[model samples]
Target: MNISYKFFSSHVCRICHRSINWEPKSPVSIASASRLYSGSPSPKNSKSEDNRSKEKWWSISNEWKIITTIGIGIASWFVNAKQDRIHSRKQMKMNLVSSQLKELYGPLYGNRIVAETSYRAAMKEYGGLRNYLEQARKERDAEMIKRWRSYVWTVLYPLDEEAVDIICKHAHLIAEKDFPEEFDTFLKHIARMRFVMEQWKNEKGNLESTKEFTEDDFLEDTNSSGIGGSKSMINHLQLKCKHLRKQQQEYVEDISVDNLTLGMLNKIKI
Candidate 1:
């Protein structure tokens, strides 16, 4: 069986849902049916009976075999064609799904998914594009994931570290500002309160980091270069990361479906 491809991606099967017809009947040739009994004894009656039996089996077998094979071929073709159609549909569906997911979650969600997917797919391709994979390779990846993930949703594509850091600054905004319920809308009020607690925990890290970099902390060091302050800054950053990780674990704990939040989550559009 042959399938038609969209030469320019415009092929549509308007008749895909049409029904198939059963076979048309045709009369059998008697002379052909009698030839199998040519060598029989009693020449007339025995030959006729023997020929009749052979012809019956042969006729039934051939008719069914031909019909079965044709039916099988058509069925196989239909199955294969349906699989291809489903795959194409999945491709389109994933594209839309990713976008809708991003849109509903906002740019942060889009950045996270695209950067993660592109990173994962690229890692499979050449063990990760840590640096550029040559000009051509970079272009190919950009184009492919573009078709795959809307080309990272911008020329900048993956948000830089600074951008991510900026986004991290917005927990208060997420808590205070309006958001669609889609962002964990099913979560209970207690869950939303827990989210708020998690937000406070994260902000606590930022505050601690800021505190560690105070002028007093710097002034205590006599060194002109303030190497003590530098090390303190590194330590502060590590503490912040550790705090963030702990908060994440706590957030996951709070949001477990087995135990849920009530009001805060009920407010969202999700």
Candidate 2:
């Protein structure tokens, strides 16, 4: 009897075969095995890792914090300095305006008082002269007429030129919005005062030149003549002046550095 036997072998891919053939390696020693399995480091390695983590980064952060604080302080200082400069400039402008106002005030109040007093005295002297002229005419005394005419010329005092000049020189400094009507009224009265003085001077010259004076000759310029008319004008002017003075004083007193700046800025805006 003859018997036949057969042998078979299994086959796999190269990469898969290699993977299946590979065996997991065991740690070299018990200590290494303990470290690998426990997921812990040796004492020496742990200390080294701790040292690496403790690098100078924390000190760098502290330095950066200090630098950031200094930068903020410097920026704040610059801002404050700019504000101070602006404030100083504003203060300087205010002082200049205030000085100009002071100069104007001195002459305005002082000279106005003098002009008012002089006008009142002139009015009184004019009445006296009119009475004396009537007496001289009735008695036919030429000497008495001459005396009264001289007294009339001597008694009338002209308004101060310096005061008018001061007002004109500094009128632009005043804000037009502040008491505009009163300001205009004052200026008109001042002009009228000058006109009245000119008229009186002309009349006085005529009285001096004529060899023989008569009532008709004295009242020749009927339209613009008469000391009585001048007195009425002066009285009206006095009322306007009194109101103007009160307004001006109040306006000047209310002025302050802040308000002045605001007013100027408002004008610029317009």
Candidate 3:
């Protein structure tokens, strides 16, 4: 006999008024099982059980992982290569600076001393040295001035023995505290040699080459020309003559073979 239920409309069995259980379950066709049955809810009404099946927890695919690992490695390699290129460029710039500085050692050393003195004399005014160099470049080309200024700046940057000597040789200005005694002694010796040379001036009386004079005679300041007032004046005049001679010798040596430097010639006492 058919029974009616309050929730479900009618033709239900009294023992089990549930509509789905009272009616016999229908056999699903293959087509319906594949399509309609897949969409239908289960009689058990178990959603948690269906969700558990999806959480099977399987291992990741090796091929997908391989692709990801390879991709990361390639990215890292590119980044490293870019970094290496930047480092190479920086090193190249530094090397160029060092070479230019090396080639300019002699010239720069001289310019540095003069520039530094000018800077100091100006009461440490404006800025350190660039200011002084700009001031001195009125008559000269700016490039030459800059090179000289740069050289001076480099040598004066550090008060090492070699640098001080280089600066003092080319200019009158020197930091007394930084002067080298051995170098001074060498200069004095050269001056003495120059003095000794003057005493042996060409004589009219002698036919054989020229008559010679001794060191004691070379000390004479008999010339009365050009501020020849006192012993000091005579001494200064003698010194000037010697300095002029030394300079002439320098010009000759500069064009000589093997690029013989003024400093080297002086050191050699040539």
Candidate 4:
């Protein structure tokens, strides 16, 4: 008896609606088919594999983490140190300005006020300083001369001397970068008055011998172009004080801001 067989490469099942291969397969063909199916990965499997690859790529070693941490710490320390130096320098500047205002300009300004008040009073009583001295010299009235000498010795000389002493001691604190021209005139005025006073004392209140000493030389020049002008030393000092106070306030605000920033940084570090 002879048998005949018909073979189909693939056929669809009626009930399950699945395709089945009816061809015979060798081991090599079966393995190749299996590999082909696995190589074309599904969406779910691709995503999971990608996640694992990303985890490995982004992983940090322990040694690298420690090194990075130390680098950040050093950078933070340097920044804080620089800020501290800037703050300290500003504080020192503020202190110097305070000293200038308190030790030098403050006392000088006060003395000037008192001296001006006393001078106005003297002028009211004796019809101005230069005029009174000239009248006293011309008239040579013993009582008038004595009173004038007493006023000069008691009030004017002492005030001038005190001003000179203040300048001598605290000249470093003067706001001007250069020595003031007004200061030279003031010193000269004091020196001339001192010489005249000495001569008057030696001569026993005699006005005849000291005739060479003129009013311009022996008296204080109230109008020496800059003394009582709009741009006087007192005005300069007042302006300087105002500027310094503003600067000091700015320094304080900056320091406060720096402190606040440092505090926030410390919190972040913690």
Candidate that scores best on TM-score: 4
Q: Candidate 2, TM-score vs. the true structure?
A: 0.44
Better of 2 and 3 by lDDT: 2
**lDDT per residue, candidate 1, 1-270, as tens digits?**
133355423333333323233333533334435555564344477789998999999999999988887787676566556655655554554444343323322444444445455556754755533332333233443333223222222322334332344344543334214542323232232233333323222245421232232232222121112111222323433443455445545544443431233232233321
| Most accurate candidate by lDDT | 4
Q: Give lDDT per model, in order.
A: 0.40, 0.53, 0.41, 0.65
Q: Model 3: per-residue lDDT, tens digit, 131-247?
A: 444444443344433343244334432433343355455433321345444344434533453343343335563111212322222122211011211233224334433554454
lDDT of 2 by residue, 1-270 (tens): 122222222223556788989865754567777888999888789998887777667778888998987787676566556655665665555554554446654455556666656655644754644564565567766666555444434532334455557668877654334634544555565455445435433455554433465563333231122323334434543554455456555545444543655444444310
- Total backbone collisions for each predicted model: 15, 0, 2, 0
Between prediction 1 and prediction 3, the one with superior lDDT is 3
Candidate 2 clashes between residue pairs 3 or more apart in a chain or in different chains? none
TM-score, cand. 1 vs. native: 0.24
> After superposition, which runs of candidate 3 have C-alpha atoms over 4 Å from their true positions?
1-69, 102-107, 110-270
Error of 4 at 159 (Å): 2.5
- Which 10 consecutive positions of candidate 3 have the poorest summed lDDT? 220-229
True-structure lDDT of candidate 3: 0.41
Worst lDDT run of 10 residues, candidate 4, spans 1-10
Cα displacement (angstroms), candidate 4, residue 8, comes to 32
